[model samples]
Every structure is written in structure tokens, then in C-alpha cells.
Target: MSIQVGDRVPEVTLKRLREGLETIDTYTLFDGRKVVLFAVPGAFTPTCSARHLPGYVEHFNDFRSRGIEVFCMAVNDPFVMQAWAKTQSVPDGLQMLSDGNGEFTRALGLEMDASSSGMGIRSRRFALYVEDGIVRASFIEEPGQFEVSSAEYVLEHLPG
Candidate 1:
């Protein structure tokens, strides 16, 4: 089953390119924090680039003002994620994370087989609002859709 509102985030190491390639575990990123983690099927793809990531980039402060740290995650390598962040002009505080092997995605039961598109295993488009290591809300998009997981939607539906 997919991760639910009350599920604890799984422990897995995700990569991010900051000063260097860094491996951060789920516990460190989510424990005792309010976070909005949005996943894309692939970085730099059409909707993800034009709408998804940009939406977060545009509203990074809106989330932060509410005391939530935002993170963008994809199945691509850290290098691609870093490049996408640069190209998108992502804010410094909006973290770009890499689940290169799809371990984290699979652990959440959100992995999709995109082999037909030559992307292989990838994350489904979804967003989660997590507080102190437990999911407070989850917005999982239907296949080939983008409405529910958008930054605007997640922000509107965040639990009080």
C-alpha cells in the first residue's frame, strides 16, 4: 500500500548536491520538522519543469512562512537534480533531492514503471505534508495528472 496520512516516513538515504554530493537519511530530513516533499516522475520533463517545480519555486516563501521546509525529489541522479534546480532558479531553501535508485519511492509504494518511456523506474507525482516524522497529509496524483499534487493544492489542503 502507498504511504498514508499516519505513516512514518521510511528510513532511506537520498542524495543531494550541495557543497558536494551529500547523502541524507529520511530521519534527519523529516524528524521534528514540518516538511512538504513533492516528487516528480522525472526531472526536466514537460509538466514538471513548466508547472510543478516552478510552482514550488514561485511559492517557496509561502510554505516557509508557515514553517514548512520544501523539498523536490525525483528518481534522477543528483547531478540531474542539481542541474534542474539551477535551470529552474530554485530558491536556496527549497532542497532538491535525488532518489537515484528509486529506493525511497518504492519504500513509499509510489514507484512507477516508466520503462516504456525509457525512464525506467520512477516516482509517481505526489506530495506529502509531514510533521515530526509522521505524515500529516498526502496528495497523490492520478496517473498522467497533476492537479492534486501541485503546490497550490497542497498548500490549500494542509492540515490545521
Candidate 2:
């Protein structure tokens, strides 16, 4: 089943790049924080590289001012994620997480097959507002759409 509002995020290990090294299973990172977790199909894809990830990176301060930490995920290896992060002048507050093997994406029921495009299993475009590891809101895109997971959508959902 798709994860919904009020659902606790499954205790899944997420691969991330830190200090020039790959870090795995860092679930403790989200503990006691309000996180805006967004996922894209893959790293360095056109939409993901040019729009989706950059949108979050740009509005990271806005999210922090509202007491939310922004996290981005994709079904790429940590090295790719790290290189992608370097490609942009990413702000310090936004975190780039890699679901290298798609385990975390699969656990969230957010995995999708993109083999036709030469990208194996990947994550669907989606975003969630999580507080203390429980979902407060979720915005998942319809297939081939970017209407819901934009920065503006998350801003609109943020409390005043």
C-alpha cells in the first residue's frame, strides 16, 4: 500500500553521501525532526536535475524558517548523487539522499519500473511532510506529471 498521512515511515535504511564518503542506514538522521522528504525517478535525469531537485535546493531556507528540513532522494548510487549535488550550488540546509539499491523506495511502496528507459527500478515522484518520523502530509504525482511535488505545493501545505 502507498504510504499515507499519519503513517509512520517504515524503518528503512537510506544511503547518503556525507563528507565525501557513502553513508548507509542513517535513519537516526530524521529522528526528532520535521522533514520534507521528496523523491525523484533518478538522479541527473532532465526534470530531476534541472527542476525537481533544484526547486528544493532553492527553497531550503524557506522550509527551514517554517521548521522543516528538506531532503531529496533518487534511485542512484551515492557517487552519482554526490556528483549531482556538486553540479549545483546547493545550499547547506538541503540534504541529498540516495536510494542506491531502491530498498527504501520499495519499502515505501513507491518503487516503479523504468527499465524501458534504461534505468532499472526507481522511485516515483512524491513528497511527504514528516514529523518525528510520522507522516503529516503526502503529495504524490500522477504518472508523467510534476504538478503535486513542486516546492510551491509544499509551501502551500506548510502551516502559517
For model 1, residues 1-160, the per-residue Cα lDDT tens digits are: 8999899999999999999999999999999999999999999999999999999998899999999999999999999999999999998989999999999999999999999999999999999999999999999999999999999999999999
Count backbone overlaps in model 1.
0
The C-alpha stretches of model 2 lying farther than 4 A from their native spots are 20-26
Lowest lDDT 10-mer window, candidate 1? 148-157
lDDT per residue for candidate 2 within 64-92, as digits (tens), equals: 88889988899888888888888977777
lDDT of 2 at 25: 56
Q: Residue 106 lDDT in model 1?
A: 97
What's each prediction's TM-score? 0.99, 0.94
Lowest lDDT 10-residue stretch of candidate 2: 20-29
Q: Cα RMSD (Å) per model?
A: 0.5, 1.4
